[model samples]
Target: MQRIVLFLLTNLAIMLVLSVTLSILMSVFGIDRQGLGGLLMLAFVFGFGGAFISLLMSKWMAKRSVGAYVIEQPQNNTEKWLLDTVKRYSDKAGIGMPEVALYQSPDMNAFATGANKNNALVAVSTGLLENMSQTEAEAVIGHEISHVANGDMVTLTLVQGVMNTFVIFLARLIAGVIDNATRGNNNQGGGLGGIAYFAVVFVLEMILGVLASIVVAWFSRKREFRADIGALEKLKHSQESQLEGSMMAFGINNKSKFISLFASHPPLDVRIKALRDSQ
Candidate 1:
């Protein structure tokens, strides 16, 4: 729940900042606000721009948020094994070697994030290493590698860009109409009617953003299944059963319906069934 709130609030801040910046630029340039073309241009500028910026900053943010320490010089056997395992998988997956790291988390979770496939960071939790057997831990690593190999982060960013474009475009378009109706020919801005317009746009953006996330989450679930399949294939002929069981265990133990609608991965049961069915 804290993560969800943080993510939402961060996105809200980005959108608000970009909107205000663009508004200022438009005023300076004397851009006409009477056309769909101008609105769309502005939307794309801020929408895709913000998505790409976030993508580029993802690795740095992940490290800070989780206190992930990259294994520059492996100090222990486990760190050595982690670096070796990731290198082996990256070779098979046909991607450049990714920086491997460990974070201090009690939860059995891991993630991969970067701007591109060749440049990525894969990090796992301390809990995952201590709790899971060697085979299970390797499977988890393979899953994260698959995410990088499949370019899931880049694709997700593009999808978000498109969604952001539409959300901004629609919110402002509706807000303009409301403003015009309320003012009814008054050209002055910053009146009570202008305040109403701003309030309406803010509320509408939040509502539309929520709706857009459903689509993003749907795509995310599909990718999770694909990544599972990729992991199985990558680890084929080696501890297949252990990998499957480990993934299922991780999912089942961490199941929650509260954020299902906004979850990046599908429910554990669904993922387990998909893995079993695929075999």
Candidate 2:
């Protein structure tokens, strides 16, 4: 519940900031009052539009960038078993059967993505398959499935799209205002004016972006807790092993490769602790 609240609040704040900043920017650009609604609609189109497009293209992006091999229908006995396991979990989670794929990454990681629950993909790294025990692998897969079941990827994309619009709005607005203030001036303004204005806006946006990222990261950490809970609940019906150890095992095994910024998931210590305390 705390995680859900944090997720909603953070996204709300991002949307609010983006809307207000865009309105301010539009005003500074001398946009007609009558066209404000249209402009806002355009903003929404660009924001949500971009996000949904990216979501749609996620499979292609992953395949291209990471060289993911989609195991289409998993034909052989071993492949069939893997597919069956995924199917079982998807059924247990009450979500559609997600397409399972493999990617060759040295890092022991797995991620799930799609625009919606029915249309989803789950990809596991070679390291994850090779290193983790069967129980541990199932637990980690549970965590990734939880991410899909919880619709986290879509939510994050929405939040990010809103942030993007705000960044664009603020940077342009600040630039326009400063440019206007410096207009009709010679050495006092013109030559250095545009550059100076841009510099200030850039700095301010960067600062805001950094702070926003921290907030986003905090929200992300909360969601990890919820996903852990989901994993535990799934395990109750499906398996007998403790979910807490799975995260610890993952961390202990791959601590060297886990980079915080690139990793949307929280640290394993935090996840393990949260699961233990919750149980």
Candidate 3:
């Protein structure tokens, strides 16, 4: 619940900041409100800017949201192993060593996130460590390392930015059209129409945001598969079973179809089959 609240608050803050920044930009440029080209440009600016800014803050947010503590010095055997495994993979992947951290969660889940491959965070839940074998845990780490090496985070952000651009542009355009029609019908050119315009834009953005999420989710699913393959290639051929088993564990334990359309990972069975077939 805290994670969800933090996510929401972060997004709201980003939107508020972008709104203020764009307003300033529009005023400084003397951009005509009626110009489609100017509006489109403005949309892209906020769209991409917001996405990148979120990426920049992702590591900090993850740490706070999950109470993840980065292991600067290995305090125990498990911590030492975690740090050593990550460094081994990081060296092989040719990326800067990522900050390794552990978070407390009862679910077997791990994630990799950062602004770039060179500066990333690989965090695993304590539940995952307790549940999975050392081999399985390493496999999970490999999957995250693959995400960094392949630049999945940056690519995902770009895709999100593009979707955001279109969502913003189309929502405003439709809202303007509706507002104009409402004004025309009332024969009053200005008064309450601004209110209607904002209301309509908000509703449309909500609806469009859901649709956009489906698209983003689809890309996320694909990337999961790619990350799996990347992980296999990084690990030994003998560790294939461990890789597949770890994925299955993640899938079965964390699987939920309630909001599958917006899920970031593919179904567990599908992922397992993909890995086996690759072998």
Candidate 4:
């Protein structure tokens, strides 16, 4: 229910923002409003549809790549603890139950991905289990669960697809309109107008796409903080100091050189600082 609300609100915000920007750009450049509107409509459909499809397939892709083992919903006592913890946190965060999987990977990393919060998958590397204690593992699990609850993966895919569709449609739409408007008035405008239009749209899209990606990345970073806070709260309520210690244990990964770039979770130092400062 919460995920549905956030999804609708976020998409509404994106459409509103795009509409305002497009209107301003069209007015300033004397561009055709109808053409721009059509282009945007096309983009919205393809972008959102493509992203949703990708989300649906993400589980299969991850399982194939990482060789995930989907446990049969926690039969024994130990499994019950893991299952119950996920359930408690998922309920508190207002998301659905996720298919929890353990994967084999040397790197200490974990991630959550899915089409929706309910139909999600959270996976952890074997390295994480081998090195970190149960408390740390729970903290990691809480963090992964937070990603699904917050809809970070779905949101990122939506934004990326939207940008891709805009870039592909806008350039062609603008070029077609320009070619039609200036039929035979100026040979130079007719001859080079398409090229110029394409160039402008391409460059503008690239720059804007980079800026947009940064915005998405910033959102991702912010969510990491939220998830950490969630984890801390969950642990604290359970009367366990394991959350902090688990984070610290995982943070002690100086040997892994490229961990920063590959890791979706924020740096250990940042997590430590935030956790400490939260007190």
Candidate 5:
């Protein structure tokens, strides 16, 4: 629940910041946002621009979000093991060694994030270390390495950017049509026409935004499965039992049971079944 709230709030803050910043820049430069071409330009800027911005800031954001610190030197045997595991899997996955960090979370959670595959950060929580066995932890680390190896962050960003562009473009286009139809070719602003245009836009933004969220989430879920497979393939001695065990650990907090569309990962049971079936 905390994670979900943080996710929504962070995104909202990003959108608000981008909207304000871009609007100010556009106004200062006398950018004419008054035509199909202009609307598309605006949409692309707000959509793709936001995704890229987040991508570039991903490592920084992920670190802060989880309060994880990158291990510069192994302070202990556990930290050394963590570093070694990440390095081994990363090598197998054919990516550079990602900076590994540890966060103070009691829940079993870890993630891979960065601007790109080669330049990435992988962080595991202290809770996971305390709870999981060596093999389970290896599986978890392997899964994160796979995410980096597959460039999931970059692909996810592209998917988000495209979805965002279409949502913004379609919302404005539909709102403009409705406004024109209602006002019967009024070339003025304010009053009912302006109100209707904004109202239509607000409503459509909500509707389209939800739809976009679903699509982005679906893509995210699929990537989770791919990353799972990638992890197994990367593991030198991985077996069916290892695959099943690894994902079950990863899916301990899986939230996809009820809201599959909005859920980022598939249900735990489903993931386990898939891994076993593939092997």
Candidate 6:
């Protein structure tokens, strides 16, 4: 929960900073957000700028928020086994060994995050280590390692940038129109007070942002399925069984489309079916 909140706050802060900065820079260059080209350019910068910054800072923020500590020296069999397994899988995946860490969490969860495929951080919850069998943990680590090798972080950043672009563009476009209409002007003029205009844009951004999040999450789910396949390939042989026993539902995917839009991963049953169908 803390991790999720911190990650979101970081992204939001970046978005806010970039949005304001882009507006100022564009204004200095005589670029009007009302103009189609200017609007697109502003959107592009804000969208991609915020996303890339978030990517660059992902590992740092994840470590702090999750209270994860990298295993510099294995103190016991569990830590040693964890470190060795991660190395083995990362080697097989053709990526550099990621920093393996553990966070004190009760949930059986783990994640892989980094800006580069060759350099990454893979962290698992304490509960996962305490409860899962060796094969299950191996499957879990392979899944995360595959995420690093597949460069899902960068891919997700691109997807987010595109989504953010649309969100920014559509919000500003509609808000500009409304502002003009309210002022009884044909041109894109701010009839609303300065505060009101900004407020409108803010509201529009929030609304469109939710829609954009759904789209991004849909893309993420697809990406997750791909990582699952990557894990299957790298772990071959008993990969299907490995995943079946290891993969757990990370979100409420069966609720509805709207709910599923916010899911971190597809349901375990769906994933299992996907695995079988693939082979």
**Count of clashes, each model:** 0, 0, 0, 1, 0, 0
Show where candidate 1 strays beyond 4 Å.
Answer: 1-7, 185-192, 227-254
**Tens digit of lDDT per residue, candidate 3, span 130-185?**
76678877888888898889998899899989998987778778876665665644
Whole-model lDDT, candidate 2? 0.60
| Best-to-worst ranking by lDDT | 1, 3, 6, 5, 2, 4
Which has the greatest lDDT?
A: 1
lDDT of 5 at 33: 34
Q: What is the lDDT of residue 162 in candidate 6?
A: 95
TM-score of 4: 0.60
Poorest lDDT segment (10 consecutive residues) of candidate 4: 239-248
lDDT of 3: 0.71
RMSD in Å for all candidates: 5.9, 9.8, 6.0, 11.1, 6.0, 6.0
Candidate 5 per-residue lDDT over residues 118-183, each given as its tens digit: 889988778678866777778778877887888877998899899888877787778766666555
RMSD of 4: 11.1
Tens-place lDDT digits, model 2, residues 14-43: 545654665566668766333545555556
Q: CA lDDT of each candidate?
A: 0.73, 0.60, 0.71, 0.58, 0.69, 0.70
Candidate 4: the clashing residue pairs are 136-246
Q: How close is every model to the real structure, measured as TM-score?
A: 0.84, 0.67, 0.82, 0.60, 0.79, 0.82
Which prediction has more favorable TM-score, 1 or 3? 1
Which candidate do you rate higher for lDDT, 1 or 6? 1
Mind sharing the TM-score for model 5?
0.79
Tell me the lDDT of model 1 at 261.
77
What is the lDDT, from 0 to 100, of the residue 192 in candidate 3?
Answer: 31
Give the winner by TM-score: 1
> Cα lDDT of model 6 overall?
0.70
lDDT of 1 at 242: 15
Order of quality (TM-score): 1, 3, 6, 5, 2, 4
Steric clash pairs (candidate 5): none
- 1-279 per-residue lDDT for model 1 (tens digits): 455566668868866777677667767866644567877888888888878997898888777776789999999999999999999999999999999988776656677889989999998777677766677778888888988998988999899899989988898888887666655346665423545656677788888888887787678777787445433332232321111111222221234556567666776567766888898
